[model samples]
Target: MGNVKKKKIALGLQLLIALFLGGAAGFFLPQFASFYQFLGQAFIRLISMLIIPLVLPLVVVAVAEVLGKNHFQKLLGKTFLYFFAVTTGITALFVFASYYLGFGQGVNIGQEGASLEGIATGVKIDEFFLNFIPSNLFKALTDGALLPILIFAIFLGYGVGQLEQEKKEAFLSGTKIWIAAIYKILDAVILLSPVGVFGFIAKDVATTGVDKLLGLGQFVLGMYLGYGVLALVIFPVIAILYKVNYVKLFKSIGDLVTLAFVSGGSSVVLPPLLKRLKKEGYDEAVTDFVVPLGYSFNLEGAAVYFALATVFLANAYGITFTPQALLFTVLLLSLIGKTAATIPSGAIVVLLAAAPQLGLPVEGVALILSVDFFANAGRTALNVVGQALAVAVLDSKKEKTEKVEKPAKAENVTGKELIANAG
Candidate 1:
């Protein structure tokens, strides 16, 4: 354990150094941005290649094991309830904050050529619902459609749980073997993250440039401010409530957090995050269940970005929202935030899909896109932290509940033994 911790600290320092070096390279040697971009993108692709294979069997085995336990419903309910409440609360707060603070005020939409070419604008209610159920599971896996894969995994896991005990155990054992193998591969991929982070940060800084970021300074600052409060203030408070050592927890996962921030992709950190949470003594079942599900549902960081970005765009378009309109926007964003994990550039895609409905100009999204990377870095880091914290808190609660139950079980056993002795 001591060795592992030392290694993590070493890796964390390496990532920070890489981030600095990358930023300098991007700023001073923009000529090599394309090369940096290639390195960064290749790293992401390597991680992405393993996501479906890792998440599918992992979720299946987790859900199956949880269902085989007595506390399945209670655990599942608590997890989703936590996710929904936290995400919705963050979304609402940021929506109101961005509006009142005039985050997008005086911003001009000069990036007219910024096209929403690939992203589909305007929500299709039927299509959105249909997406949750993939017509072809293989197609969904190929396309990396996470929602469908998750849905399929859950049902498959539940079905496996209903099988004869021996069969179920055999199936689970096989899947566990598969998941373990994937982790081995994933760990190898993660060791290259310093190189990846350097390239990713370099490419982003070089391509986005400081002037464009400065122009959208208010929006970027507001987004980071939201991320800061969530990570530094709100999450610490949650850690306290759950009796988790906030400082120690973050310290242990500092390397993964840095990677998430620099890479701007939370999925890349999932493997290490899970391993670290388990090492922290969070229940294996709960950590496995909550963290993956949290990726899909409990995106507190994306909630902040989406809510703030919506208001910022609205403000840029000089669109005013009444109480009813603001309420509606908050609700819509809270729902959209759930889908953020399923798509690439998810928050951006959902924002595009939602802009038309909110009466915000689609072109405004293009303007926000210019500085999205800066905001994305912060949000992705916050997302990773939030997921870990959720696991810690939920595990704490589970432990307390078990502690209360064990005494009752002891009493019952003692009473039975006394009666048997008396007889």
Candidate 2:
């Protein structure tokens, strides 16, 4: 019997078809778009089912590992501070690029149907402060409130950090098992994303017409520009500083990122991604820690999108801010951007959060609301690739430096010397 080679179908291809169908349905039909909505909603909900559990245990493990009251603490503190600093810088760059590129001047002038009159665009500073603490855990979960969850996570992780060695090791072992189980569940669900993608695309096509899409093109262009600046300029330069080859890193993870672009949700393709990085000479500790941290804190794509979209909406409403308002907007964007998920609804959350603060008509967000789902597929993929590379460079440097002292002894002694001495 002749042997036939079986071909493995890549998830990226399926996600591409989903994107095409969903976009076409929303832009072409612009009438019966509920079908796409249902599909996209299904895909997002499937992911939501995975993130809470997947993230919590992983966070627990990462915190326990990083806060060992030794070198681990310094390593983590440095990595997080670097990521935070760069993210803030990237935020500034995006705001600057948006202004310099004149994205504000391109807003829709006569398209005034979705009114957000009397809507609260500005948030009180004190209430925003109070929202940081979780008054009740159950209430937070029911509301999908991220800040409270984050506070709880930080506290629990700190508690884990305080455990005795034997107990901590026991917890770490059990936590790993739980994390593995969650990942398996995540993988199974992600395999079903194509159906969700197709439905989302087709339904969006059925509702929003092509002409309306054209009006939003400028803002889209600006967003793409801002994202490129960070990925290409900011992140690569950081890699160079750390002596990591940026080109090699990109080439290594290109396929996984393409899947992210096609799938529109990086979270769906994360299992394969972590595995791929492990194959490419990176540590599992780094991948597990950095990937989740990036998801929670490092939102480069949404950082760009939030600024660009907010400006677009602001322009549409004829609202121009002074330098103070602009600075405040950037600060708020830092928080919203960090919370931005690798999901469709994330953009809406950011848009609504910023609208009231900037006096950008909240309803104007509806303009980009439909396609924002697909817009961020590329964004999420890019972000995952960028953050993964960042982690690789940081961890490689860390691992290399830790090994510096061991290598000198290798040069001075050999197995022959050891055997002679033993005899």
Candidate 3:
């Protein structure tokens, strides 16, 4: 554990150094931004390649195993409901906030002729629902359509759950093996993140110069503001309802929070977070189940950023969203945000994937990519807090349920004493 922590710290320092070096290169040597651009983009593509393989099997196995066990059914249902409600609610709130508060109003980073007008007029409510049901599964897989793939995986997992035990176990074992292999590949990809971060920052700084920094600053401030609301307001309300001491809860996990903030990734903090929860007397079963699931599904921080960034970029490009368009955008972000756990900086990859579909320019994504490290710090810290809170709440609920169902013990009496009394 000590060695792991040391290594993580070492990597964090490496990334920080890379970020500084990249920015300096971009500012002083704008002519070579193209090289940095290639490095960054290649890293993104490698991460993208692992997403489907990683997400599909992992989701399938998770759903299958959870559904197969009757004991876990209720826990699974509650966890999923909590994750969905919190993520979607936070996403919608930020979507409205970003639009009303004018998050990206004055920051135009050369992305002209891009508009959400077509989306406003063309996206029918029914069509949006239909998009999740792919007519051809093969085509959906080939096209890397996340929504359709996710819907299909859920159904497939459920089907597997209903199978005979032997068959189900066989299938699950096979899928888990595949998932393990993919995770190994994912780890390799993540080791290259510093290089990717450097390239992205250098390229953007060189191409747009310092003029774009103002817009980047605005976006970062907006993100931190949203994170503040979640940390200060939304999560406190949740903790209160669960009978948890919100302040104390955070204090207990402070080390993990710091690690998450510095690392800008949740994967590294997960093991220690789980250990901390267990040490704090949270239900091990609940922590083990919900914390990991929350990483993939309940990324409140990423959800907020997704909604905010989408609207920010739209406004930056001089587009105004109608009510219907805003609603569609919120729904799209809520769904895509679930994919943020597939890799480090996975939010950017998912956003880039959804950009063309959202009618936002690809260049807009690149602009956001340059300063993601700054945004990710706050984002990942909130992610760590959110996951911990979810476990705490669920475990509290489980304790309450167990208490209610527990049978009271009879008063103790010796056999001789009972016989004498009866006589």
Candidate 4:
């Protein structure tokens, strides 16, 4: 009972403190809003810096571990199959929901709702496939080509797997230590989230007022609600079916989501999220690989946002959506967008690219840019939660397979338990 009360108090403190700091930023620095903007930008930059090195080591370490052990390829094949299926399923769910809920349906918001913008308008599938392979890795970097970065990460992980076992283990172990240290720094960064969340939220609300929210309100509302339902309802149901109850499951990771929200960047939230999933009965191996992989490839919020935003743009421009056209748009985004990696400007770039592909307007992004930062906080929170959930599903399937081979149970206990057990 005392512990429960303590948890409640701690949570309350976080919420109140975040609110206070956010509100205080507005009052204290009334004239210099740019300073607050820098504060948010700096926090996001730190998260961005941390994510790349974070992913490299995790991918390298995880690949070494998975490949050196038993039936690694089979496990990986099955995991990817499930991961892709789940990612697509989540994407499909939102696309359908957007259409069903009829959001941004009647609104006329974008100037060229029907323009192909700068795209070639129509391209052959084979040509697009050919484009996926980077013509120049250097050029891709300068050009912000996300698909190439992802292909590079996969190749690097696989190459790391070809090394000798002992050497690989040493490398993995060293990388693991560095990852742990990075996570510790992540925790310290998270400790600052409440202050950061408040600043961003309060400032966004103050400037936009409620009017902007009302203007593109349908799309904005859809983005948040879709994620909320998926994260709270759909994800929890998926967990329970996997034999993990959603209540404890969601509660287990609540702190991390809240932390991610405050931090305004999901990458900063990744380390703690991976840890929480393990504590909640997911495997470290699966979480390590899937979370990093999912961050790059499977973004639930971005997927939903893309759908709603396109619909909003199309509607705002008085462009009608044919059933066939909407289906094609959903299909392309699920395939291309899901494979895209996590980065600071990824969603923006993708959305800009998407406009021409879907025959929507590019200026739609400019119209939404101000709201992106605000909306993306919620996006990161949900996307990170979804990544953790995906790993939970993968972990469940593994548990099923292991049990079929032999009975299984919590094989060990450590941390505070080991100390108590030692005494």
Candidate 5:
């Protein structure tokens, strides 16, 4: 126990130190851009390698296993709706607030290195159902088409759920081993994360000097402002309302939160998250179902960033939207982009997808990419917090229901015994 605590303390410090060193290197040693970029890309690739084997199987297995239990379907329904509602509502609010604050007004749109010729058509409302079915599963996964991959996982999970009891058990057991083995490998990879964080931040700083960040200060400030409100105010209120002790909850999950912020990959922090949830007295069944699903489906952080970036870019390009148009643009893009877990640079991919359709200068993507490291720290941390809060809320409701049921049964038994004694 003592050794574990020491390691946890050391890990957090190491990441923080690495971030500081990396930023310093970038500010002071711009000539080493190539080396730091290589290091950053390698680290990102290391995390990306875990996506297919980890994400698809984890989703399928968790869904399949939970489907066999009582009341889980209802739990699953509530979980899905909760994530969707919170993500959509909060994201819309940020976009509107950022717009009203004039985040991107009077910015000159850079044309150099900006090519908008091949922007894929945005998702149409009528075609939404058909868009989920990829022409080729392998290609979709390779292309990082997140919605297609999730759709595939959902189908495969349903198939597994239909298996005979013994067969289903055997299959899930095998999956458990596969996931565990991958997590063990991931544990090894995590040791190199400080180095990865250093490389990633250094490269960003090297490529875009501090002055460029200052030029975009309004947008960055707005982004962080949104994060500050969500983390400090909104999430805590939700926890308090649900009867979860907010202080204790954050204290318990501090390590996972640090991992989320530093690594900027919420998927990579699942092992620690699950362990923490279990230790904090969440049911194994609830954590098992919610955590992985949260990774794939519950990216509140990414949703907020998407909304802010979209509106900011629109403002920069001097594009004005009617209220209805703004509603259409923000909701469609933000919600669609939230369909799956993001890779390290996934926000750029999402920006590219939504920008062209909204008449936002595609080049505006570069602005956000420059400050992605800082943005990602806050965004991914929120993802972890959102997941934990979802579980706590549901578990609290479950406990209350049990309490009500237990006393009623006991009272009925006591009443029946008294009547029999009187007779």
Candidate 6:
């Protein structure tokens, strides 16, 4: 345990250094941009390589664990509601703030590096929803489409839940072992993250240069300001209502937040997050259920960025969103924006995907792509925080329900009140 804690601290320091070193290399060493870019892509690919083996079985096991318990449907409903409500509310705030601030009004990105075909826009809403059905399960798994994989895992886990008790235990036991092996592999991959962070930032800096950053300053500031409102203002209100110790909660998960910011992907942070949830006294079952799905679904931070990007992009092109278009964008983001995690530069892909529907220029993607590493740091931190918040809130709800039930269970067992009533 002591060694593990020491390693975490060491890793955190390494990641911080990588962030600074990558930025310096990018800013001062533009000639070697390709080299840094290679390192960054290599790191992303290494982690991506682990996704199929790690994510698939982990989702199956988590869903199976949830299904085998009582009130499975109830738990799912409540948690999903909490995720949607918080995400929707915060997204509205982002849109309102960006619109009022007029972030992208005068900014214009050069077309030198902008390639509309290279962007992943023009995906229709019908097609987006249809793909969720997954015509080929193997293809979906190989392609690393998380929503389809999740769908497959849910069905398989439900099947496992219906098995005979002995067989169910055996299956679950085997699944746990499988997941542990994958985690061991991920442990090896995690050590390379600092190198990855350095490369990613350096490459972007070398290629994008200072001009893009200066031009997009307001959008970037507005993006961070939105996150600030969500983190400082909104999260605390929810925490207070849920009776959570907000300061303690943030401190406990600070390392995970740093990991997400540096890695720029929340999927990689799940193992440590689960460990923290357990250490912090949340139920193991709830931890298993909430954290995995929440990683894929509860991306409130990314949603905020996407919302701000939409308004920012519209303003950049001197376009305006009709009231109907604006409402549609918010609703779409609240529902499908989180699906961006299924692809590379997920937050950006989400923006591109919604570009057609929202009437924003597809080329605006290039503008955001240049600064994605910095933007992703903030968004990814929020993703980690959002998941942790879900666990805290839901776990608190569970405790309250249990507390309310304990007296009834005692009353039934003791029967002294029944005897007194009879007399």
Ranked by TM-score from best down, the candidates are 1, 6, 5, 2, 4, 3
Q: Which wins on TM-score, candidate 2 or candidate 3?
A: 2
Tens digits of per-residue lDDT for model 3 on 105-179?
Answer: 888566433332322222343766787688999999998676677778778877988899999999988887886
lDDT of 6 at 61: 72
Give me the candidate number with maximum lDDT: 1
Candidate closest to the true structure, highest TM-score: 1
lDDT of 6 by residue, 1-423 (tens): 556643245777788888899989988988999899789778777777776676567667766777776667877898889888888888877776677678678876554545556656655668777876778999997777777777787788778888898998898898889878877777787788888889877877788766657866777887888889878988889999988878788988886688677667776676667767877767766777787778777888888888888888888888877667667778987766766773336788788778766766677776677777778878888888888888899875657456445655573555764443232
CA shift at 168, candidate 5, in angstroms? 2.4
- Residue-level lDDT of model 1, residues 110-158, one tens digit each, is 6473767777676677776788888999999998888789889888988
Instruction: Please provide, for model 5 over 286-353, each residue's C-alpha lDDT reduced to its tens digit, 9 standing for 90 to 100.
Output: 77667766776777778778888888888887889888887887677655675434556566666776
Error of 2 at 179 (Å): 1.8
What number of clashing residue pairs does each candidate have, in the order they appear?
0, 17, 0, 3, 0, 0
RMSD of each: 6.3, 6.0, 9.6, 5.4, 7.2, 6.8
Per-residue alpha-carbon lDDT of model 2 for 6-71, expressed as tens digits?
Answer: 786777676777667666666667666676677667867777776666656666676677677455
Clashing pairs in 5: none
Better of 3 and 4 by TM-score: 4
TM-score-best of 3 and 6: 6
lDDT for each of the candidates? 0.83, 0.69, 0.74, 0.65, 0.74, 0.76
Query: How far off is model 5, as Cα RMSD?
Result: 7.2
Tell me the lDDT of model 3 at 267: 62
lDDT of 4 by residue, 132-235 (tens): 67778788666545455545655666777888877766777788899888888776775665555666655654465555555666666767887777677877
* lDDT of model 1 at position 121: 71
Candidate 4 Cα deviation (angstroms), residue 148: 5.3
Local error of candidate 3 at residue 273 (angstroms): 12
